[model samples]
Target chain A: MRAFLSSMVTPRALALSALALSFFFMMTLGGPFYYLAAFVITSVFSLLDMVGGQDNSDNDGKPWYYANIQAYQIPFAMLWFGLIYAWYLGTGMSDLFGVGGFLKTHTGFDMFAIRARTTAPELITGGYCLATIWAGFGTTIGHELTHRTWSKVAIITGRWMLALTSDASFSIEHVYGHHLTLGTPADPATARRGESVYHFIPRSTFGQIISAWHIETGRLARKGQSIWSLHNRMFTGWAMTLAYAGVFYMAAGWKGVIIFFAISWFGKCYLEAINYIEHYGIVRVAGTQVEPRHSWNCNQRVSSWLLFNLPRHSHHHAMGDKPYWELNCYPDAPMMPHGYLTMIYIALIPPLFRKIMHPRVLDWDRRYAVPAEYPLIVEANRRSNTADFINNVAPAE
Target chain B: MFSKIFGSATKPATVTILPADISFIVEPKKTVLLSALDQNIKYPHYCRVGSCGTCKSKLISGQVRELTDKSYTLSNEDIQAGYILACQSVPKTDLVLEVPKLRVE
Candidate 1:
């Protein structure tokens, strides 16, 4: 029975369930409660993580199952965008192909009435939900598929998913820029010690775009093509984002445009927040090999199930080609004190996050930092106004 | 259809590293750098994701399935000279590579 239950509650099942629940709640719940889908899902998963404990079992699941699950997100994400556009269209602009009227006639469901009654506070909550869904579904799957460099289908789908958050450049910068320069000062995604999530968001947001632009231009230059051409991925990606904004504009006018940008910006900020925590305070000497210890790992059961095992990040960095299901739990890597979602909540409050994480960083310095890395760690601490624990230490000769 | 649904079975491909006089069989679907590392042959590598270009080697002979675009890291001259990232290249046939960074005892 235990074995059967374990097989039934697989990661693929959990991911599919998340999509189904999100669809059901947002579709069925009218007015204010429509916005609570993401919040409820995150809350349930976070609670489960805290109670269910860690799962370090080897993930020997079939690759096709996980791949299909990720592919399913493409249609669901498109439907999510379509639903939001319709909601924004409202009673004032659109009858949504008279589906609203049909429902009103047949089911007495008053869709237009619900839209009319939705308050500003309700819309704010709706925006937050949109951000969460975008971050959770779009970014994670996008990150996975973009790494599949060998497949054209994967790359196109992945870029479109990231384009939902106005982050298509991530497909270029993350694989080429951040992966190469991670854990060093050169990496824009790597948060310096004592850097707040607030500060890291803007710095990383702009830094990634600029880095991606340079990378695309350089690639084009190698191919003897102009950056001004449509072949420039940054240009094409930005065009896709603008097209999305155009759809939102058609849906709800200026207000719809504002809401669209709001969701996109919030989604980008959430990605940066994840980045801020993933490698917070970890340092490595430039040109040194990126090892498992460079990334912080989490093995919390619920978070692992919901996140498609992104918590096994250290192994991902060590071997990028391995599918998400194949990512191994590197037990010796530096670990996060809480699940990924729980850590994101803690990281929001800068002082509290530092208070919890600073000691761990110091411990990493003592145990994980090689002799060559001692000076780099010291300098990082000094520059970031970190505690004076490693201040007096000199580089080992 | 089975291969499409589930990945194809592993078939070992021979890899010969020149200058260091190293030879290894790259397991099916495994990148050359990883296969070398698996066999305890220290083929120098930093980021295995074709980013840092630390694992760039001259493909002396044989076909390879390049996983990621190498233009981001390798120079035009290097590409013209047949350099490929071992970390991103899976041997499609028996491969002979000139790895300048291969650590020799």
Candidate 2:
């Protein structure tokens, strides 16, 4: 009994169970209409995860992934409660004042039934706000966790939350593909120099998904594993999503599923937009090994708070396994000019960004240049005589 | 070796201002911006990573070498027009750069 209780209470299982209960309770309370909406939202994310969650195994062990899971647990739990409370407040407020009466006096809308039937206005709006925050935190954590050694519980919990945000596939592409070939032309996530966020997102989203399919297919072929194999993360994610949609269809029907998809897609897009901003214009030099300088860093306080310190990006790239809470600001890491949100707003204006960024870039360039007295020639000459002694094989080898 | 690493062996270069008739001594290995900052000269900068083009300026004359990290932020056109990142550009020879005073907003 104790062992069973402990298993049920593990962070991964707890979160998964909470999300499931929330989905069912909300649907039952709001009727089939709301349930369909939730289903659609989750199913879409499930599909994305199916495509995105491919081979991301690394021999480096699972400490980092586990750490990320632990780091995100508290914040996500808080966000979940915050959403629930916010919904309760919004509905109570609307009903207390009689939404129809309030609207009739304020906006002059004649649809009495619409206002009267505002079952949970606060719940709808507040739920969305909280959901957005959850999506951000959960998706990042889920992405890391899914890459760990197989834990049936972890996979289900992580992938389910990821799908609800319509970003399930990020787990696969980011860990498996992007990290493996980061800063290279082959990696879709690495932004080219002078590329804007607006242009990078659509291309990366589609490109990464297609690449994920090829990666998984190749992996299965090599290992003699069938596409239908239960061990496949991609297959499992898709199957769960399809199963979810079927559940939605059975419980609340198509309408609930559609609504769920719309909201989840919106959340997913928001997350992707952030990904675009996080590493915009940051590229690793082709044929060179990955280095910290290859990724952009932001240390702004508010953006860091909002995204659980995700803006301290260069370090994350250098050590993807570091838990979000423990991620540090490295002085040598290139710094973003502003907070992530402010930068996102600025990214919309290419010319303004270019004008503002040009000098800073030039300044950084000039700062890192080698001194004239210590030119490459001088260093080469100094090393020439020492080279033979160091190698110990004479010049023949 | 210690003196060389600390940049104490070399005599600092002087930048002579034409109209003001004032001059400042610039330390070796310090970018013009850093030197100016040391002398309490505030300059504009944002996203110091080179992605946000905030700190661009035209070089009037003289040679400047860019730090390796800042190279990605500059374009060929910028190099041709004598534009360099003040934050990145260390004076190779004495430099006469036409830089806009940092805005006081």
Distance (Å) between predicted and true CA of A323, model 2?
2.5
Model 1, span A94-148: residue lDDT tens: 8644666777799898777778777777777667777776777678888888888
TM-scores of the first chain across all predictions?
0.90, 0.60
DockQ scores for all predicted structures: 0.61, 0.01
Candidate 2, chain A: TM-score against the reference: 0.60
What local lDDT score does residue A213 receive in model 2, on the 0 to 100 scale? 69
Q: Could you list the chain B TM-scores for each candidate?
A: 0.88, 0.66
Q: What is the interface RMSD of candidate 1, in Å?
A: 1.5
lDDT of 2 by residue, A258-366 (tens): 5455556656666666676665444343334344665567665445544556776766766554456556776576666766656554666866765655444333334
lDDT of 1 by residue, B9-101 (tens): 256789999888789998878889988888888888887777888889999998888877889889999999999999888877889999967
Chain B TM-score, model 2, reads: 0.66
TM-scores for all predictions: 0.88, 0.50
Candidate 1 segments whose C-alpha is farther than 4 A from its true place: A1-19, A27-30, A38-42, A60-63, A78-82, A93-110, A388-397, B1-13, B26-30, B103-105
DockQ of candidate 2?
0.01
True contacts kept of each: 0.69, 0.00
